[model samples]
Target: MVRRRLVGAVRSVFNDTARGERPVQPSDEALFAPDTPIRLVHADVTAMMVGGVAALLMQALHPRALQGVLDHSNFREDMLGRLRRTARFIAVTTYAHRDEAEAAIARVDAIHARVTGTMPDGSRYAAQEPGTLAWVHIAESWCFMEAHLRYVRPDMSPADQDRYFAQSGLVARKLGADPVPDTRSEALALIARYRPDLRGSPDARETARIVLAGTSRKPAERALHRLLGEAAVDLLPGFARKMLGLRRPLLTSLPTRAATGMLANTMRWAFGR
Candidate 1:
């Protein structure tokens, strides 16, 4: 019963029932073949939860992405809502059947179609922009796979890694991103190419700050949230961390990473999946 409660609580973070909404029941379980690597990788609760944080940290580095959030969303109050929607989208696209996936993708695209704004520098920003979409997609895929490798399955084969990236591109393209990278190295290189365009700003820094702070909860759950934040910070690229003034101590870096890994395991045990 304790394990079940722990699992329920973990699931509740992604589930909307706590907010008086129903859990997202699978529309169809035929999205991927039962044996697909993508299914296996994403099914790990620890990696998905940790990597989701890391991906958000990386995404906050992109100026327009951060600006879009500031200009468009009531992010502070509805933070969990935002996370639940993203998780729901990923779950549907990755595990639901083709029709459900397409519907989810189309719903997101329709929402994106309506989000438009001008940045502080008087540059136009649109949620539908291919570049922005690609950044979000790649950041998510990169962090997710990284967490999977680090905490869940260190020995994941290179071929499977490539397959995961290439396979993830399908969802990216469906979301209207052009030039989605279909290989591991290419995805990293694509992020590199965008370095000149990525910048640290007040908005970006604040986004990172709020995301890391997490929500109020009981002692054990609050501790889990704190550990996830530290793990996310650990997973961030060195320059990215510096950009947001999130520099960790050099002496404690090794121990911190080890602790974060252990916490991830504990989270998974609590998840009981």
Candidate 2:
């Protein structure tokens, strides 16, 4: 009963009951093959939680991306809902059947088609821009891999890591990301190339605060969320932390990692992973 409740609680956080989202079952016809690195990296709920936050921080540093979110998304009022939708999209694209995955991609593409606006500097931005989409994709995929390595599998093989990028790039390409990297070196190089375009605007800082502030109300859950948020910040690169106005205190890093590792183990146990 305890295990069931734990699993149900996690599902509740990731799935929107009003929209009738249940747990996504793995299918034989999923986009990637079984036992692939993408599946393993994306399967860890706890690590993904940490990585997702870090990814958002990195993505927000892109002015066009930040402007797009500020203009089109109700993220300020519905942070949890936005996160839930993103988690659902990742789950669907990673584990659901190819047809389902393609449909999800189509839905996002349709939304991107409509997400266009002007930035504060009189620069226009569109969600469908290849370079912008590429930044978003690389930020997210790299952060997810970093979290998995830190919290779940520190000794993840280089070849497998490259494969993970290659597999994930398939989805990115479908979503119109240009110059998608299929290996670790390429991913790092791509990020370096895009670094000049990233900025820590005031709006970006506020969005980062909202993301780290979390949306939980229960005291225990809130405390856990805080710990996860700290770990997520710690997982970010020093440059990114500086860009997002996040500091990684030398004092809490170790304790936060230990606590988050414990939570990851607990979650793996609950899900029979």
Candidate 3:
């Protein structure tokens, strides 16, 4: 019965992403095959959720990015709707047929075209801009891999990491993020390079609160939501932690790890094998 409920919860998280999307089915041979690095890297549902939230928080560290989200997104009224859209895009582009992936990218690109406006200082920000897109892309890929390393597979080889970074660039480039990094070191350098431009603001904090405030109708699922939220905070970069004022006590490490493992294993079991 526990497994049955877990199966439903996990399915809702991913399958529902396609709710309002134009259907995109995977080919017999999807973009990433079963044993490919991309498949191996992103197959864990729990790690993806934990890392995805961490990435969202990290992305908002950029003032312009946060401003763009605040100014344009309907996050207040429909946070889960936003998350489902994002998840759908990722799912279609990564796992679906090439035509489906292209369709998803076209839809996203059209949305991004309208995601432009002026910042407080009168500087302009557009989601499609190279720098802005790169930041979002890198933050997402970095956090997802970080979560995979910590919770799903601690022993992920360095070469595999490099390949994952390199291959992920395919999607990033498609999204118009030029000069995406090709290796782990470059990925870290990309983050470091943007430090001067990244900082916490009221927008960032508010977004974090909204992300953490995700509640489930089912009581069993509420614990899982909190676990993912806390794990996201714990896995964030020290600078990110400081920016968001999310400090993790040293004593919480073991407990955090234990909860994360449970979440990961539970999802894996529910999904099978």
lDDT of each: 0.82, 0.93, 0.82
TM-scores, one per candidate: 0.92, 0.98, 0.93
Model 1 per-residue lDDT tens digits across residues 1-273: 887886777678777885675554544455666657777788887778779998998898888878888878877888777888888888888887788788988998998888899988798999999999999998999999998998888999988898899888998997889769888899999989888888877777888889988766678767877777887888888888888889777787687678777767777777554
TM-score of 1: 0.92
Best by lDDT: 2
C-alpha RMSD by candidate, in order: 2.1, 0.8, 2.1
lDDT string for model 2 (70-122, tens) is 99999888988998889999999999999999999999999999999997779
- On TM-score, who's better, 1 or 2? 2
Q: What pairs collide in candidate 1?
A: none
lDDT of model number 2: 0.93
Candidates ranked by TM-score: 2, 3, 1
Error of 2 at 74 (Å): 0.5
lDDT per residue (tens digit) for residues 21-49 in model 3: 34345455666655667777777888888
Count of backbone clashes for each model?
0, 0, 0
TM-score of 3: 0.93
- Tell me the deviation in Å of residue 177 in model 3: 0.5
